[model samples]
Target: MINLSIEEVLKYERGEVCNEEDCKQMTLERSQSNIFMAVVLRENNKLIGHIYFNQTVPFEFLTWEIGYIFNQRYYGNGYATEASRRVLQYGFEELKAHRIIAMCNPENASSWRLLERLLMRKEGQPIWHNANQYAILADEWQRNNE
Candidate 1:
């Protein structure tokens, strides 16, 4: 999952976006503490999107935040959905997550709809960015998947 670009690397490093490089050394350095995955098309081997999850809380609680973005040209083909499902599976099965959460603007119908498709329920309607928070528990995921 060391496919974070140089711009994302430098932006995260120096607090700004600069370049997009595929250099492995820089990728290894950046990928150690965080998880960032680039989604690519298997038929053509082209990068179309990315999804990531991380702990951003004082207490771990085995909870993680998942987010994703895909090229507009690649939309409507289920690429984002497939990538998100894989990440959610890994979080629940491998990482033993108690819960996984996602956030998106309420205005973005497609985004929240995708979250709904993943069986996440909307829990919060924050005014900040008019964001909607969605979450799914590990038990819920397991039952649904099974």
Candidate 2:
């Protein structure tokens, strides 16, 4: 529900926000999706990080692919993981998303680790994107109490 400035979004796009451009494109695509959100972190009102998702059909079933990024200065602080966990809860428990997935470059050990920490199963190998390919899918998320 946070308002992210276009400048802030662009900063992410240019890789100043995260070391990865896939992270930036995810933010841009989320802004376009309208169904998605880019939650930003602020300190003294300065934008510092973001988390977002998009609905995609990587399998026969509809699913939402979640993504996130935190400023390099903010790394090791658990911001990205915490935000991702909350967003996954929102997507599953509130939005009623049938499945949620996240893709990351195989070299992005931190991101892959985050997904694993969330208990998202590695669904498959790399898939193509913007002239590059990477690991895809986590799994369908099921809210136990539901």
Candidate 3:
């Protein structure tokens, strides 16, 4: 199988690969949010992939949404999981978010499974993007980690 690389992911994010400028702009706009937080890794100080969180639309008061992307070369190495967990902890413990949610394309099995492994409950199909939503509450998170 062909692997997706971080360079590819970044190109997609920057609207260079996918021809979807909206996605690149959305990421840029969301990055400006005060509540945004990220978990990143590097080799010899060179940046790698990142898992990040930001306030979800219309629920920006307390709930948040998360997103992540890693180099396809890092697939199956647990790097995404490890970094995501740290960001989740930061979202709840540091940011005091009451809830955190994530959504992924339905066809992406690995993406959904990662949310499940993080103890997020499947909330069924979302209204847009043909993606599935998963969420976890702060109390639920605390209980699981405790």
Candidate 4:
């Protein structure tokens, strides 16, 4: 059990108490993989979120999944949408992915809307008690971008 103010908790979660050595080692390892990347503010270089695009099951298919999480304080500013759109573009153009998919709880309107804003097609409706799935094919992405 710990007693901490909301501000204190946010600072801790932001890595105020993190070990420099551990963070450096982690940066080295994570930097080796293009699958994950940090989203930083351009003005001050503050870490705001992370976005990843990685191969899925049966890797030969060249399918990938894109996902992201941003600081609550930074939502609705188009950061997530911009970062995620870039990630999806990388998967299609650089990774040569045949398909890129994303899933979000339909109840999360902002999240799903962001996905749609990326030009991903909704694969299914919200009727089922499951997360809404969306996807974009490489050709479709290219066509849209072109």
- How much lDDT does each candidate structure score? 0.77, 0.60, 0.71, 0.74
User: Which parts of model 2 are misplaced by more than 4 Å?
Assistant: 1-45, 58-60, 127-146
TM-score order, best first, reads 1, 4, 3, 2
Output the better candidate (3/4) by lDDT.
4
Worst lDDT 10-window in candidate 3: 1-10
Candidates 1 and 2 compared by lDDT, better number: 1
Q: What's the C-alpha lDDT at position 138 in model 1? A: 98
Off by over 4 Å in 3: 1-43, 59-61
TM-score of 3: 0.73
lDDT of 3 by residue, 1-146 (tens): 01122245543242233334654564466457654433344555433455557777676668888888775767787877888888899889998999999877777788888999899999998685677889999999999999
Candidate 1: worst-modelled 10 consecutive residues by lDDT: 9-18
Task: Please estimate how well model 1 matches the true structure, expressed as its whole-model Cα lDDT.
Answer: 0.77
Which ranges of candidate 4 are over 4 A from the true structure?
1-34, 125-129
Backbone clash pairs for candidate 3 read 4-72, 5-72, 6-71
Clashes of each: 2, 1, 3, 0
Writing each residue's lDDT as its tens digit, candidate 4 over 1-146 gives 01112233233132243355655565567668887788898999887767767889999999999877666778789999888888887778877899999877766777788888888889987675557789999989999999
- lDDT string, candidate 1, 1-146, tens digits: 23334343222122343234534554455446466776889999887766768865755689999987665667799988989999999999999999999987777788889999999999988875667899999999999999
Estimated TM-score per prediction?
Answer: 0.77, 0.61, 0.73, 0.75
